[model samples]
Target chain A: MLRIAASGDWTIAHLSAADGELRSLTAGPVKAGRAVIDFSGIARFDTSSAAVLERTARLLEEKGLRVEFEGVSEPQRRLLDKIDTYGTPDTSKAPPAPFYIELVERIGVTTREIGEEARGMLGFIGTVVSAIGRTAANPRRFRLVPFVHHMEKSGFDALPLVCLLTFLIGAVVAQQGAVQLRQFGAEVFTVNLIAIIFLREVGLLLTAIIVAGRSGSAFTAEIGSMKMREEIDAMRALGLDPMEMLVIPRVAALTVTLPLLTFIADLMGLLGGGVVVFFMLDMSPGVYMSRVQEAVDFWTIAVGLIKAPFMAAVIALVGCRAGLSVTGSAESVGAMTTRSVVRSIFLVIILDALFAMFFTAVGI
Target chain B: MAQKGEPIIEVEGLMTRFGDHVIHEDLDLTVNRGEVIGIVGGSGTGKSVLLRTILGLKKPDAGRIRVFGIDLAELPEEERRLHERRWGVLFQDGALFSALTIAENIQVPYREHLHLSQELMDELAAIKIAMVGLRPTAASLYPSELSGGMRKRAGLARALALDPEILFLDEPTAGLDPIGAAAFDDLINELKEALGLTVFLVTHDLDTLHATCDRIAVLAEKHVILVGTIDDMLRSDHPWIHEYFHGPRARAALAGK
Candidate 1:
């Protein structure tokens, strides 16, 4: 006789232990044909156990044994009938390709997608440039109201946050510099370190990141929703230029406002550094100002200032492009808005690095 | 045959109001066992609200609802769950959980209400998927991947997971094409016969009423105005009822009759 051992409370509560006992049977030997599984010692068994029973029977059959139960309850027998009808899941569609081959295929697909995105961004840039030219040719057609509105939003609204953040960054830089320089009796040079660093890179880069997070995402969401509602198409149908009416004012405002915001951020950073110097090293404000004036070069300020328009262009273009790419779904609007902020901030840091390398190479 | 036993669901003096707006007042309904009752209404006639109140998803200002002869307010929490487990509801828009696959969606009620293993649950889900006429491969696909009709079928499969005696459908044919709607009607009729279920279908589709419902309940003003066969709906003299049954869509639907 083929022996079948069934034990424990055969339910979902005891599934792990029951399945364990069932798995152990696979490792050992069993004869082919008929087997009686005893459920006399089983305390309780439910539908979950019926599934285990079915699986156990299938496994036993694979080992060339036919299985039957000795003492199944009425309910369990009915549930067993259900399990017998459903059979097993078919995993036929699973790809049998090698792992490395699939990995390479995925990489290829992603690279092509990135290439298409880059091409689309380039096309948007060309359209924006032509739109800018058209605005320049007919200056009176420029919308002053919306331009001012955007400036107030992207610039004036950002003042308090930008000021507060830059102040803290500036303080950390001055404190760190003073700690290192004071060791060599050159604590006075902390002013030069703060001025050069903030003017050339830190203040402007931080501001760009903040603006990308705040204003860039807003631009994407605005334009994306308009596209989703078919308002952009409506504008086009009514002989309105979306580039001039929507894109131009926003881009123009960002371009003009970013430099002003950067200049203010630089001043705040200097003030923060001075406060840190005063408290930590007993450095006087008078001495700090003279040092800053001495170390502050026109090229340093011009470098950061010149980069502002380019950074603004990057934010506006990426934001608008992401918006324009939105299809019919509201989900697309959300995705594009997030992409707009992430891409703008990422490109800003990269462009800043390029500027640093170029300035150093040219010995500016 | 429908009136052979006591009503499975009974609603008496049901009143629903939102702030100053009254959606329903003194509404009464009796649904017998093993019958499909179609609810019809104009826009803002609170057909969905009545379904919600009956399902206990929404609380009315004042009412008495008896499902399976138990007062819902008096039933204890565990007992209430037991009663709830005996019924199933399909909402409009096929509210399938976005994260789970179609099969997994069907398995949810089973996982919660039954003591079944992962294998059994998976097998049962696959069975439900096929029962709803979806391809076996569709068991692994997410709700977002399915078309509108497939989504509704998946939702129906999930509703049928627990082998519920009572099925609640909200506008089941609203978004489907004419052919798909007819097929859905046939599926409902088949399932009702095969399972001996009492179906409460809130619908505006006149064709569906002719095809599937054993009785039509017309809601007007604030309460059920009429409850009878399609022939009785034709004989009703109420202005709203007269215009609705004699409307172009209704005439076209009755063309086959």
Candidate 2:
């Protein structure tokens, strides 16, 4: 048995047997009357290569020589069918026609147009920002009625969940702090741990996250649906600034309501931690209350209060920005609502961390 | 018939692009006072974009959009808002606030722009709701409780709250049953005649187009290819134009004749 291993660059020229030497080499061993073609070494095969193989098979049959084919890859088999269909001398040259070039071009043009639109949107953002700035400058002109409605929705309606989550978080924190403080024979310090953290960070953080998930998502969905319905356009047609009439009121409401909610959450959380301190640490209610009062200073409360407006601003901005970014259909409203919640919570946490750093650096 | 005064809206070379997709390019159109022009087009052909650009909600990339003789692009944000009060737009969805009662929705624009007393605002809201044919009892109900037709009517009432000179309706009769749509068309016609409002209506419903519009502007092939009467459109030799106005679907729709 004659074994033949053939491997080379499977270019069109090589596959086509364009060179007399390569053709003779493929034909010579077969003509000598014993050969097994090993195709495993062949990395690439084209129509021309398949045609050469078919031609060699015919020549071997004519010479009364039995030839065995080996290592025929799937791609090679597919090429063989293509060669047979086209009656392959394989003169077709030039790269296989690009299927996606038109799609790519269309996508490119679309991307450029979208980029321009985004740039224009930047200008609109400036307008929105300035409008917000003006409203901030003239708080009286920004009516309180809409803001009052927003507060009822964002704050009052969200109270049950805020209270529940803060209570649970307070219990968890106090329990965890007691475990560590007891190791240091400072079990009484659990009151300070729970009180200080609850007043300074955890209470405000939990409240903001809840509001971001609840109110922020609500704002995005509401405005996003309005956008989808062209209600925003209708407002514009009626000579109303969507920012002033819609977003400003929402932002203002969140700004005012978040601080109040945070204060509420802080109070509730401290009460919850007092429960844990009283039971787990064997401290009396009066003693826990006195310890918390001594441990948490006004500055700690102020630091948390300061972070509330910032968190509120983040929630409002992310909600409105995501809502404003929505285009096309109802699906986009849902998508942006989710995006608004995620971005608001992320920004709130980041802002909280920064506030923590600032307070710590200033030794406040 | 156009009067000899300046057009109420003059949109010159208006071009709007969303990302790489060009929705409208070099679009020039005019809306005169007291003329109801219907904008008819296939889906995604930018009929809504033109109305939105005119309203200054979607800014045109390269165009001069002037409404009520003021260049919207040149006006400051506050001034643009002042200019906007001159027009009214009824969205297709009748986007009433779900939380507010019908009366409160009508009071929104008024309360935002005016300093009227609560009783006076309530009175004005009642009048507007009555104009839309809703009973006084309907005023206290939220939008979620109202029927589709009633919501559309309430939305119309809210649009008319400012007493705008120009009115725009986006698919006012869409999704409504035949009788409801006809009733809406009748309401639009009555409102148009009573107010002498310059109306720009965007619609796909052929019956609404034939019954209500003074003239129809067909958007095709990335342009407003034709703007004429139904008779003029029927006479045109353009293939798509013919297919649109006199096609099998259209013929079947009008087959009762």
Candidate 3:
């Protein structure tokens, strides 16, 4: 006798318990003349349950058994019929491309993005330069309040952190130079090492990198959110120039403050170098101060000082352009803000390098 | 097809409070098998709080919540999960995992509960995506790519993944346009009957209540003040209910019926 039996809820939760029983029925008793499938004990049924029942019926029929579904309710049959209509859905996902192809694709995409961004940045420069020219033509049109507000936030508020960071870095450079000079029996020359490095390069480079991280990301996030909320579009609709109202003030604030911040950073760095070498080496604080003072009088200090405003302009322009490029969504704001910090930092380092080569070539 | 229609869920003397603000007091509700119950309330009335409390997401301050003839609070963790597997809850928003595709989102519960092959799980997910009225191509799309209406449908598909006998919907029609809302109503009604489900729907959409609910529970003054049909709600003298049913938007909803 070919007897098939199913009992229990046969719902998704209870289907696991019924799995072994169903599997046994599907594999056992094939090539039967007649089979009786009983569903008398089922209390609950759903699409999954119906799927199991329909799977069993098909398996039996494929085995050439004349299947009889006993106690099959109308609702149960209807659900089974529903599943039967969409016999098997296509669930195939596209396979990922090969490694080299993917790598090439990534390189192409990155190159294209850099080119597009370069163009966009140039366009932003054109707009802001014209806006500044107009503001210069009529000084009354300049937004002094917003410019002061941004300067207070990005410059004055950044003092303590910049001082502490540059001071600590200068101390580290002095201590290490002293240790290395001690091996050469010329520990006194640690003053030359610390003075030349901090005044010529480390101080302003560190300040510019810090500004890129702090002020650049902040500006991008702020203006990106405004763009995301259509506030930029609203300002345009109201005939207020975003370049004047938003961009000019931000750029002006950073340009004015970054050079000042860089000067403060150089002072604190020299002070930090003096303190460290006075403790670690035979050089007196007076001698260390003399070397640092002489270095500042040369065009070396001027090179670092001049790089500050240019780096600030780079950070400000990148941040504002990235912010303006932001489409609607939190994701866009996040991506463009990150891009702002990265691009500005990269450009700052490259600009410092070019300035270094120029100073050498020009005998500064 | 045929159920005993026994009381599947019973809550009595329910109390809920957030800090000093009391949300529910001396509240009682019973959900019978295979019936759609709508919970309606004003803006601050805690209709969602009650639903979340019943789903065990929030702890009720004081109450007796017996589901499937067992005290939920007293049951062992494993034993309680067995009872929990009998129902599914859809949140107000889709709440689909942001990083996962629609297929992966639907497969999450199966991956947790079932020992099936990935191929079978994918097939089941595809079925669910189709059953909830989404195109087959939607399976590969992420939740971020979907519109608000499509996201709700995707959430419904995830809710239906386990084929539970009870479905808990939180504002299923909240953001849908009129035609979309009506089609959703029809879909819910059809699914409830076809799958022999007991639906507990919390909604602000007046049309959804008219079309899908067998009984409406009005929550006011920190309790379910009344539980009855739309006609009964219309006939009642409760101040809020009177204005709610006779209000301009309510009249438009009723006329659209």
- Interface RMSD, per-candidate values to 1 decimal: 7.2, 38.3, 2.5
Sort the candidates on TM-score, descending order.
3, 1, 2
Off by over 4 Å in 3: A1-5, A13-38, A41-44, A52-68, A130-145, A229-245, A325-332, B1-5, B62-84
Candidate ranking under DockQ, highest first, comes to 3, 1, 2
Question: Model 1 reaches what TM-score against the true structure?
Answer: 0.81
lDDT for residue B80 in candidate 3, whole number 0-100: 84
* Candidate that scores best on TM-score: 3
Candidate 1 chain B: minimum summed lDDT over ten consecutive residues — where? B1-10
lDDT, model 3, position A158: 92
Q: Give, for candidate 2 chain A, the lowest lDDT window spanning 10 residues.
A: A84-93
Better of 2 and 3 by DockQ: 3
Clashing pairs in 2: A110-B20, A113-B19, A113-B20, A114-B19, A114-B20, A239-B84
TM-score of chain B of 3: 0.97
> lDDT tens digits, residues A1-364, model 1?
6766777666554465656667687658876679888877677555446656777788788888877788876655665665566675453446679999999999999999999998988998999899889989999989999999999999999999999999999999999999999899998899999999999999899899999999999999999999999999999999999999988888999999999999999999999999999999787899888889999889989998999999998998898888888876677899999989999999999999999899899999
Candidate 1 CAPRI classification by DockQ: incorrect
Which 10-residue span in candidate 1 chain A carries the lowest summed lDDT? A84-93
